[model samples]
Target chain A: EAGVAQSPRYKIIEKRQSVAFWCNPISGHATLYWYQQILGQGPKLLIQFQNNGVVDDSQLPKDRFSAERLKGVDSTLKIQPAKLEDSAVYLCASSLGTGNGYTFGSGTRLTVV
Target chain B: AQSVTQPDIHITVSEGASLELRCNYSYGATPYLFWYVQSPGQGLQLLLKYFSGDTLVQGIKGFEAEFKRSQSSFNLRKPSVHWSDAAEYFCAVGEGGNTPLVFGKGTRLSVIA
Candidate 1:
């Protein structure tokens, strides 16, 4: 099966700039997630969606980050006025059912200078 | 709250030797546990997961994980180490079904020939 798809693979932006990352989850999967992975650390959840509805987003930097899964399919994560600490890999994952193992995309590496 | 911990920041092992990566989770109840591997410039891949059944669960790429409820641990192990097995390993826990996972800081493995 085709895996979750992510775009850009890499990005570089100055502080206070804006950036967006796109993701397409595996077909038939309804649960989608966005995570940020900093250097020397593990990926941290930014948001989660169950069929276009957000299930959780407690860790998201609401003032600078936003995400959407408009059609319950493709999703996008946007960061406005990026901070230097925002530099990290953005990972996208999808699960067929609740609590199932996720299939992930290659991820987009963002560097905020 | 659900949390995961990886005690080792990094480890080096010789080829053909045994390998082990420790993981411990804290949760109020029995949680779904998983092990994932991340290669440089790539995304996370499922190594194994334990939701129920036998404590020892095998995964792809010659990896396995054991869930110990008594210790609140789900450690990954490989009987024989390989150069290609060197990568960042993460342990995660979730409530299952529309819940997001809590991940550890990760442990980097280096396999020496």
Candidate 2:
């Protein structure tokens, strides 16, 4: 099966600039998630979508980070006025359902200068 | 809230040697556990998962993990380490369906020739 797909393998932006990352989940996956992995840290859940509706965004920095999974297929994560601390690898993952393991994309490495 | 702990920040072992990476999770109920591997500039790949039924789960690349409810631990193991296995390993715990996972800080493995 085709793996999850992500675009713009790398991105560099100045602080306070805006950037967006795109992801395409595996076919037939009903759940999608966005995670932020800072250097020397674990991946933190940014947002989660069950189909097109959001299931969780409790950890997302709503003031700066936002994500949407439209049509319950592809997802986009955007960071407005990106901060230096927001510089990290953004990973996208999908799964068929609960108890099923996830398939992750290569991720978008964003560098905020 | 649930959490995961990977106590080892880094570990080094010679090739063809036995390897073990420890993972501990905190959750209220029977937790879904998973181990993932991430190479440089790459996304995470599922090495194995333990949902139920079996305490010992086998994963890809000759990796295996044992889930111990009494210890609240799920540790990954490999009988013989290879250079290719040198990468970051992460342990994650999640609630089934529509819920996102909580990941550990991760353990970095280095294989010496």
Candidate 3:
């Protein structure tokens, strides 16, 4: 079986520019999550989705960040007016259920100048 | 709020030597623990998890972890190290099903011949 898939393994953008990352979770997985991993730091949860509905996004920077999982399958995370501090790896993961182990994607490395 | 801490930022060991990576968690109640490994430019892979029952858990690639409830710690260990084991390892804690994982900054392992 194939693992979770993510696009644009690497991206470079300037401050104030917009950037988006795409993720296609494993088939049949019901839980999807997006995480931000800054250098020398752990991966922090940004948002979580159960099917097409959001389950949690408490840590998401709502003013600048947004994510969507349409049709309960593919997902996209966007950042507008990106900041230099936003330069980090964005990871996507999926689980069969709420408490199961997750399968993660290779992640997108975003560098905001 | 739940949080995880990986005390060591980096660890080095020679092949065939034993290895241990420390992890500590802070949570109000019983928390689910997990260990994940990530290779350079790759995604995070689940190594093992501890929910209940046996405190000692075995994972893939000869990895094992012991969960000490009294100390609020879950430390990963391996009897012998290999060159391929060089990677970053993360420890995480969660409330249970549907909850986002709180992760540690991670410990980078270096194996020398």
Query: Which of the numbered candidates is closest to the native, going by highest DockQ?
Result: 2
As a whole number from 0 to 100, the lDDT of residue A110 in candidate 2 is 92
Off by over 4 Å in 1: none
TM-score of each model's chain B: 0.98, 0.99, 0.99
Q: Over the stretch A1-113, how does candidate 1's per-residue lDDT look in tens digits?
A: 99999998999999999999999999999999999999999999999999999999999999999999999999999999899999999999999764578888999999998
The backbone clash count of each candidate, in order, is: 2, 1, 0
Q: For candidate 2, state the interface root-mean-square deviation in angstroms to 1 decimal.
A: 0.9
The lDDT ranking, best first, is: 3, 2, 1
**Predicted candidate 1 versus true structure: per-residue lDDT over B50-109, tens digit per residue:** 898999999998898999999999999999999999999999999887788889999999
lDDT of 2: 0.94
lDDT of 3: 0.94
For residues A5-111, what per-residue lDDT tens digits would candidate 3 score against the true structure?
99999999999999999999999999999999998888999999999999999999999999999999999999998999999999999997545778999999999
Per lDDT, the best of the predicted structures is: 3
Local distance difference test, each candidate: 0.93, 0.94, 0.94
Worst 10 residues of 1 chain B by lDDT: B94-103
- Name the lDDT value of residue B94 in candidate 1: 91
Docking class of 1: high
RMSD of 1: 0.9
